[model samples]
Target: MTELVRATSGRSEVALTFHGAGDLDITRQVLAALAQHGAYVTVLAVGTWLAARPDAAKMVLDGGHELGNHTWSHPALSAYKPEPMRVEIERCRDELVELTGSPGAFFRQSQGQHATAEELLEAGKAGYSRVLSYDIDSLDWRDPGPAAIRHAVAAASAGSVVSMHLGRPGTVIALPGILTDFARRGLTVVTASKLVS
Candidate 1:
């Protein structure tokens, strides 16, 4: 498999990947914001969350965004043993397949930015050839102010996969301005797969 992070220097695409496990209403607003700017993103969803909100899969896909497995319960992959780790990856994989007919091209380990060695093994077994990690973290999940979240993500450049969250109110508030900044910099927001592809 290819290494996850790319060095596509001339590429204009910067991926805004949302760790999905939030209220349906919040996700709707996030999707609406993306729609307003004609941007696409990658949502790495937890299986338990996906199963709880069955409509979320289609909601994301319908917005021309991508959905990938983020694990079942979103525990730290490094803390899991082989069997449970395998289950964590595959269970979400199964949910994606059942809901969307295709498990997305990416898998991102939860509770961390980088993948664990064991997480990589489980991701491969679950048929994800690429694992998406981020270069910029918005830190919106911590309830930082919208300006602070905007400042954090405003650093995105070409080939950047910025980490953000769907459930974050600050993220929703900051997204429009962040998109404007990206547009100002000539950076196009695309799905993580598209950023590398």
Candidate 2:
């Protein structure tokens, strides 16, 4: 069985989730960071990105991370018709199954935005067990410096889900500090599944 870990006390455990695109460098950094802390991470990989970056995808699996569907491209599901969104979601799931050969049960909306709970229900019907969103956003995609990433993660509390990108240099530099800080605060870094379960 997977070891249980918690992000904070006095509440449901916090979740830290990462959304990854095709950028291997960023994904590698994130995986490395998680490994250093002896933790597993949740990765929502774009379907096309995974197809194009098999090496990186393998790296993530080898590092003991959980994979989730992030659609074929990073389209805002809210802006699309339900059929289109459903197609995208299924396509992502199929591609992930092909790449990792593991049945993934989580789906994260592209851009962290979904049209409604109905869309999430549709994903669930398609075999997704959870929909991920974040309470703490690193906003590293905005090119924030290391301090910004540090500050964002430091604000984490029990049950807070942090959003971060795999493609940011500042995030790489800030990862160690973030893990150490969480540990110092008596936070147990864990994968999203563990937190939610």
Candidate 3:
């Protein structure tokens, strides 16, 4: 798979990627905030999350946002053998295809871990052409408060892929300021695909 840690568009744009599978309510809140700002993002969703709330996945697509696999469950894929790893990735892809009529164009590993070479090859075989990594991690998972989250994202430069999580309340709280900061800096937030394109 083509590994992209950052976009290459060279425009005043950054890609905001959210990893989902925890809280649907917060996910909706995040989506709403993004929509309110006319910003589009990429959500890497866990398969179980989609199964439990297919409507949430639909909500993302309906909002004109991009979706990708974050594995069947959030597991450290590198811990598994090659075949099991493939199962983890492909199961998520299958669920996405079944739900959305497409498996999406990118794959993001659980916990934002870097995929091993074998994992990358398996992901490609499963139909995802790109494995996405992030240049800036919001660390919102730590519930570091809105200010810290804002600071982390505000520091993003051009071509950055700022990683954030969907279930975290801090992320929802910090999104408005983050978007405003991006706009203030003359940056446009785009999807991962759009950033690379």
Give per-residue CA lDDT, model 3, range 36-131, as digits (tens): 999999999899999998898888999999999999998878778888888999999999999999997699877545777887898988888899
TM-score of each: 0.96, 0.88, 0.97
The whole-model C-alpha lDDT of candidate 3 against the native structure comes to 0.89
For each candidate, the alpha-carbon lDDT, in order, equals 0.88, 0.74, 0.89
Please provide, for model 2 over 1-197, each residue's C-alpha lDDT reduced to its tens digit, 9 standing for 90 to 100.
11122333465345666777746877777787788888777877888888788776688778877777778888877678778888888888888888878646477777653326666766776677667766677777787799888887888887666777777788889889988888787777667877776
Q: Would you list the rank order by TM-score, best first?
A: 3, 1, 2
Top candidate by lDDT = 3
Clashing pairs in 2: 14-159
Model 2 steric clash total: 1
* Candidate 1 displacement at residue 2 in angstroms: 4.0
Q: What is the C-alpha RMSD, rounded to one decimal, of candidate 1?
A: 1.1
